[model samples]
Target: MTEITPRIPPLPRAEWTDDAREVFAYWGEPNAWEEGSKTNILMTMGNHPDLGKVYNIWGKHLLMSNTLSTRHLEILILRVAWLVKSAYEWHNHVGYGLNAGLTLEEIGAIRDFPAGDDWNEQDEAVLRSVDELKNDGVISDATWAILGQYFDMRQKMDLVFSIGHYVMTSWAISSFGVGIEGGADQIGFDLRTASGKIPGKTYKPGEVEDWTDTRGY
Candidate 1:
C-alpha cells in the first residue's frame, strides 16, 4: 500500500478547548481516548463537535448494540474497507475482526473470497452481500436467500446498515485524508488485542459459529 498523507491533519491537541474536550470525553477511555485510540478519525470529525457527537452515538450502536454476529459484521466491514481503500479503518478493524474469530487466512482471503475455496457457505453469502451492495447498491435475490438461511431479519437489516455505515466512513476518511491514530503503525491492533475497554468482553463466536451475546443483551 502506498503511503497516505492526511490533507486535513488532526487538529493540534493544543487547540482542544472545552467543546473539543467534550467530544473527546464523549468517545470515552480506551477505544476513543486512551493512548493509541483511533482518535485521528474522531479528532478529524471533532473539527465539528456537533456532528461528531451524533456520529459517535450511531457508531456506538453499530459497534456495540447491533444484533449481528461480530464475525459477520467484521467480514462486511473489512470487505467494504478494503474495496474502498480506507486503510485507516482496515488497519484498526483487522484486530477487531481477529478477536471476533476471523483467522488471518480468513481476513486475508476476504480480498479474493467466493472465487476461492476459503469461505464456507455463510461466509460466501456475507461477502457476496457486501459485493452486491458495494457495486449495485442492492442485494440480489439469490444472495439474500443464502443470507436468510443463516441470519434473521434483524441481522439482515444490520448487515445492510453496517455495510452502508462503513461505506460512509471510508468515504469521509479518504476524502478528508484522515491518517491512522498516533503511534498506531508502531504497535497497531493485533489478534491478542481486544477492541479496547468495552464494559464487557468482546463477542466471540460460539459452538455453531454463531454469536451469543455474553451479556444477555
Candidate 2:
C-alpha cells in the first residue's frame, strides 16, 4: 500500500502542554512526552489533550481491565483491525496477538475468518459476531446464543464494547492518517508478503519496562 501522510500530525513533543503530557503519561510511562509513546496513536491524540485524557481511561479498561481474556481480546481486536483495514491497529495488535498466544496461522486466519479450520466453537462464534455486527449492526440471535455458552454477562458486554471501541479507533486512525511509527516496512499487513513473518516489535505480556508505574492500579 502507498504511504499516506498524516492529516493530523502527532503533537511535537516540544509543543505538548501540561495536559498533553498528562494524557500521554496515562499509558504508564517514563513520561510519554519526554520519551514518546510506543506508537504514534497517542501522540496524534495529543493534538487534543482533553479528549486524549478521557479516551485513555476507556481504552485502558478495555486493554488492561476488561473481562475478556487476553486471547479473546486480541482475536476480536485483530478481526476489527482487518474489517476496518486499519493497518496501524493491525500492525500493533499482531504483536499483541502473538503475545496473547495466537499462532501466526490463527492471526492470518483473522483476515478471512471461518474460511480457515483453525477456530474452534467459541472462537468461531466470537469471530462471527464481529462480522455480524459490522454487517448488520447487531449480533444475531444464533451468534449471541453461542457467545452465551462461554462468556458471562460482563464478558458479553465487554465483547460488544470492545468491537465498538476498535471500530471507532480505526475510524480515527484512518481519518487522521496515522502511519506506522517507524515506516511502511513496519506495517504488519503486506499484500506482497502476506504469508511472511509479521513485522514490528513484539513485547512479552506486561513488558512495559519503561512504564513500570501502573499509577496505583
Candidate 3:
C-alpha cells in the first residue's frame, strides 16, 4: 500500500473531470513505447504547462534519444524510485526496467542500492554512480572509472542528467500529491527508505529533495 501522507494532498475527485478522464484514458494506453501505467499518467499529467516543459526537456535530454541505453536509463529511474520510496514511479518503472534488460533480482536489489546483493562489478558501478550523483552533485572517481568501461561521454552525460531529471519528477509527484496511477502495483512495490532525501527541492522547503542547485544534478 502507498503511504499517502503526502506533502500535498490530491485534488478532490470532484475536481477530476471528463477532460481529466480523457487524459487518463489516453495515458492508460501502452502506445508510448514501453511505458507502463504510472509513467504514462505522470507523462500525461506533466502535460499541464510548466511541469510539461520540464518533463519534455528532461525526457529529450535523457530518454527520447540515445543517452544511456534504454536499459541503463530504466535502471537509473528504478533506483531513484526505490531510494525515494516513490511507489508510483517504482511500479511503473520496474516493468520497463525488466524489459530494458534488468533482471528480477536486480530490480529487487534496487530497493537497497548502496548495499544491494548479486550485483556484478558493472551493476555496482551504475548503482554507485547514481548514488554519487544524487549525493555529491557530481560523479565519483570510483564510479566514473567503472562507467567508462561500458559507456561513452554522451552516455555518461545522459545518465547523470537522467538521474537529476527523475529526481525532480519523483520529488514533484511526491510533494504535489499526485496519486499513484491505478494498477500501478500490478508490477508491485517494495517499501524502501522513504526517509532517504533526494538532493533537490521538493515543493516544500526543508523537504525531501532540495532543488536549489543551479544545475539539475
Candidate 4:
C-alpha cells in the first residue's frame, strides 16, 4: 500500500472562520470536524465555500429525504462506490451500509455481486443498475424494468441521483487525493488511482480487511 497523502489537504480546524463554522454547522459540526480533526471531504470542499454550500444543499436532500430506505440507498451507494473504485467513498459507506442492515459478506460481495447468493432480487436489480450506469452511462431498459418492479417513481429517481452524487464525489476525492479519516484504512487503491497517482493514504490488504470488517457501525 502506498503512503497516505493529500494533494489538496483539508483546511485545518484552527483556521475555520465564523462563516465557515456556520456553514459546517448547517451540515452538523461532526460532518466537517470530528473530535478536532477535519473530515477530508468537507474540508477540501470548504476551500470553495460557495460551491461547498450548494453541494451541501443537495447532499442534505439526498441524505435526509425519505424517498428511499437506508438499506436500499446504501446498497445503491456501495455498488457505485465499488464500481468506480473510490476508496474514500467505499471506506466511509462500509459503516453506513452495515448500520442499514447489509452484512459483511454482502458488502464484500458487492465487488462481484451476482457471483454470490447473498443478494436478493431487489439487491441484484440495484447492483445491476449500478453496473449499467458505470459502464454505459445509463441503465439498460432490462435493468430499469427490474428496478421499476420494486421501486416507486421517487425511489427510482432517488436511485439515479444517488448514484450520480457518489460518482461525482468519487471523482473529486480521487482527483484531490483526499485523505482517509484518522484510524481508517484505504481500500481499492489500485483501481482508484488508475488515472494517475495523486498520493493518498493506502493500507495493506490485510490491514484493510481488518478495518473493513470492524467499523463498529
If scored against the real structure, what TM-score would every candidate get?
A: 0.78, 0.87, 0.66, 0.78
Residues 98-197 of candidate 4: C-alpha lDDT, one tens digit per residue: 6677776677687667675567778888888888888899999998998898999999998999888989988888888986666444444232322343
Error of 3 at 57 (Å): 4.3
Comparing 3 with 4 on lDDT, the higher-scoring candidate is: 4
Can you write out model 1's per-residue Cα lDDT over 66-93, one digit (the tens) per residue?
7997788888898898788777677767
* Residue 70 error, candidate 3, Å: 2.0
Q: Which stretches of candidate 1 lie over 4 Å from their true place?
A: 1-3, 13-17, 30-38, 186-217
In model 4, residue pairs whose N, Cα or C atoms come closer than 3 Å (at least 3 residues apart or on different chains), thus clashing, are 4-200, 4-201
* lDDT, candidate 2, 110-155, per-residue tens: 8877786567899999999899999899999999999999999999
Per-residue lDDT of 124-214 in model 3, one digit per residue for the tens? 7878877887778888887889889988988887777788878887888776766554433334454332333222211211112431121
> Which is the winner by lDDT between candidate 2 and candidate 3?
2
Choose the strongest candidate by lDDT.
2
Cα displacement (angstroms), candidate 4, residue 10, comes to 1.7
Candidate with more favorable, higher lDDT: 1 or 3: 1
TM-score of 3: 0.66
- Runs with alpha carbons beyond 4 Å of true place in candidate 3: 3-50, 114-116, 186-188, 191-217
Which residue pairs in candidate 2 collide?
A: none
lDDT values, one for every candidate: 0.70, 0.79, 0.59, 0.69
Backbone clashes in candidate 2 total: 0
